[model samples]
Target: MANDGLSAGAAARRLGVAVTTLRTWHQRYGLGPSRHEPGHHRRYTVDDMVRLQVMQRLTAQGVAPAEAAAWARRSPGTDPAPSDAPPSGPVAPADSPDPALRAAAAAARESILSLVESGAMIADVGLGDARAGGGQTIALGPRVDPAARGLARAAMRLDGPSMRYILESAVTHRGVISAWTNVMMPVLIGIGERYEATDRFIEVEHLLSRAITEALSIVPRPPRELTPRVLLAATDEEQHTLPLEALAAALAENGVPSRLLGARVPSRALMDAVDRTGPAVVVLWSQLPGSGDVTQLQHLLSRPHPPVVVAAAGPGWPLADLPPTVTPLNGLAEAVRVISTVKA
Candidate 1:
């Protein structure tokens, strides 16, 4: 960050985009570096950085690249407004004669502005203020994986594409367990904490949850020839099913197919599912206190044709009250191991 400007690499890093993306914007959209020194590579000045930031934000919100660039080119002056500063007005095309288009533009402007006003678009170039617990970023701690930070920034922006990209990359390269334990879990917990503190960002939570579900579902399932002997379900009235989703994905990663009976499953429904499926292993997940009724576990244990292994997962379950015959799964890896071993 010289007095002159920043290089392409530095600019891209600051914008959380790739150098090639900057190149595309420059060549195709004409949103390139404007500052240059004698015999030196062209550098992006503060103004150019502002334009690129606008472009990044708009495109992340599903606007077309060409349209986003048009808006970016219209960004005023060199400096972006401070995070806490009052918004000047709607940042849309008020001049547009088409009323419908203008209305849509205004809506988009408000969406972005709301995120900024909420401190989710904080001043730090990385989109994270480096400290945890703010509504703006998920605090993954000092030693968090880069992927987690990337995911957190994307989540803050409500940028579905970027979030899915980071998640898929982690699952593809690191495997589901590592992705869940090292990357996804830390950020998920951080977001949960942020929600508890601020009681805001429900949109962030919903979108992140959907993105994670999509990413996990992308893991290839076992071939049709393999019968899935593992059945997974949430406890009665339990709405937190991401942990079970992670478990299901981890099982698939190990070539163990499973039936996932998603959130808020009634007790009778679960038992009926068990009776019909005749699964060799049944895993019930409970994420909150009220949802982890010991009777649910008891019902499974008392079933006439009970599965050989009945496992309890998630923190919702009351460990002290769990039937002695039920196995408790501690983590994603352990759940996978315990269930997979039984299936094998």
Candidate 2:
């Protein structure tokens, strides 16, 4: 049956809260169900579901339910709005995209490009002169081209010292992982290409890449909790283990016990692991285009007994032909949110 309308049990399940909590909201807050049937069964609609979701999000962010409810009530027909503005304030000013800032960005890009094309190390030129007030020394690196790197660096609102610190930290960290890969990788790649195109920052790209890889390594995975058992692995030809590692870490953080099988596991091995562990969920990492043996995967997914939830992460996921039961994980945050919702 279509679940467009929610019963009390279903609503509680969807909200990730106890049934009693939902009842309390109805009684105390007057956020009652939309309708009551002849037998006194409460029914909630899509609007009610959305309101609950907004309230849940706000409450999770440390807002009191009463405040969230008031905000929701005021907003009415909209999502829950924050009671207060962010301390950092609004994102853009009336005169944003300030002319001076844009010009500086352009000049920085040009400078880096010129130096890189001429075989000069970006770190040698130093970002110190790029500063507005000539207050501090700025150092660019060999891995990125200067001008383009400078523009990107400026955009990030990072100082030379901070950039240097990030680069040094990356050297110790390791490789690209899940949400980081999705959110940061694309931006980083763009920065690198811009530097290359402008001939501004050869060192900047290299330094940034190294730093990101290092940072990934340094971020410790959380200790596994004794919750529902889950197994994680990557498909054959999907040698990137970072996403799986990240998912495992997130799962652990959420108190979902998980074991990582690492990269490039064969189909039989994956099946065997599932058989041996009898896991509730089997997370598979594959950046779509590069994944091999899809047919084998499809066949294995058809098996009965030991119901499994398959989660696919990375670039190739959208392109891959997945079974009806499989879930495409867009990024690290979404993955964690989904897992938590499932657990709840």
Candidate 3:
């Protein structure tokens, strides 16, 4: 028979905490299962699950345990009626979006991107001198998602906590692709444009990249025994590893483990790694035209036991010059699909 309420293990896994953590929440915080049936152990009801989510979100934001517990306790098994919504107290501003909207944005924002993409503000505002009184701002297209807006604001202030919270929530709920394309990409591209126009805020880019890397690393990988058949690496001396990092995390979420060689792999080192691991597919990434050379792909294809598929990915690659034997992957979704499926 199908399970009715979630088991402690399942709930813990879903929430990305240990069973012990769940137990503590149950025993100490009174956030235990409410669905009781004959004989078997108590199970977590939907209401209990909702409360736990509130607890998890608050704690991750660094709220003191006692205070977070109070908030969780105050959360009704269901959201309050529109008029009955509880007071904001001091945690959030009175005008902040409702928990329901925030939760919805947190859950999935593909539609949000679509909605925002409809506006004229999103009118491909090339990055430039968009500024507030004290700080330089990146121009995200007019039709920006709320989460993206929040992320941009956090990034501008160099607020690591808020950036981490936004990114982690997106990756955890919507998976890597949606998080990357909708939430991360807009901000990233916006920043890149700003850098192009003003050649400033290099620190902001570095910090944001660090936050993204940390958040993506949290996606659990497949079992250790499952050998990684996919390999990802940046070109020699190329420091743009974020896109490749996103691919790795996306693959892991789908249970496809990969070996990432990280930034700046020269031909000799890359070949040594390729010969050693013998990946089924090898994706070489280049973020700048200077780094993306056709010969790098040629070297892979010439290997004695070359991977069945050697794909050139990123905007840097000169797609026209690449040989017919190489597959060209232009985006994260396509890269994940191609790398995960290629035969040895």
Compose the digit string of candidate 1's lDDT tens values, residues 43-76.
7765676677667655643455777666666554
How would you order the candidates by TM-score, starting with the best? 1, 3, 2
Candidate 3 lDDT (Cα, 0 to 1)? 0.72
TM-score of each: 0.65, 0.42, 0.64
Rate residue 152 of model 1 by lDDT: 82
Lowest summed-lDDT stretch of 10 residues in model 2?
A: 82-91
Best model per TM-score: 1
lDDT of 2: 0.51
Mind giving the per-residue lDDT tens digits that candidate 2 earns over 1-344?
12335676666654445567666566544455665568766676545544554444334323446654543333334332222222121222323354432332233334334444564431212222222322211233445333333334432333333333333232223222333543334436675466656666555555554444444444445553454567778887787675566566556555566778887888888888777777766677876576844554575576675435666667765444666667777877787777666641
- Highest-scoring model, lDDT: 1
Task: Give the residue spans of candidate 2 off by over 4 A.
Answer: 1-183, 186-188, 191-214, 217-228, 318-320
Cα lDDT tens digits for candidate 3, 230-312: 98999986889999999999999988989999999999899999999998899999999899987878999999999999988
Q: How close is candidate 3 to the true structure, as a TM-score?
A: 0.64
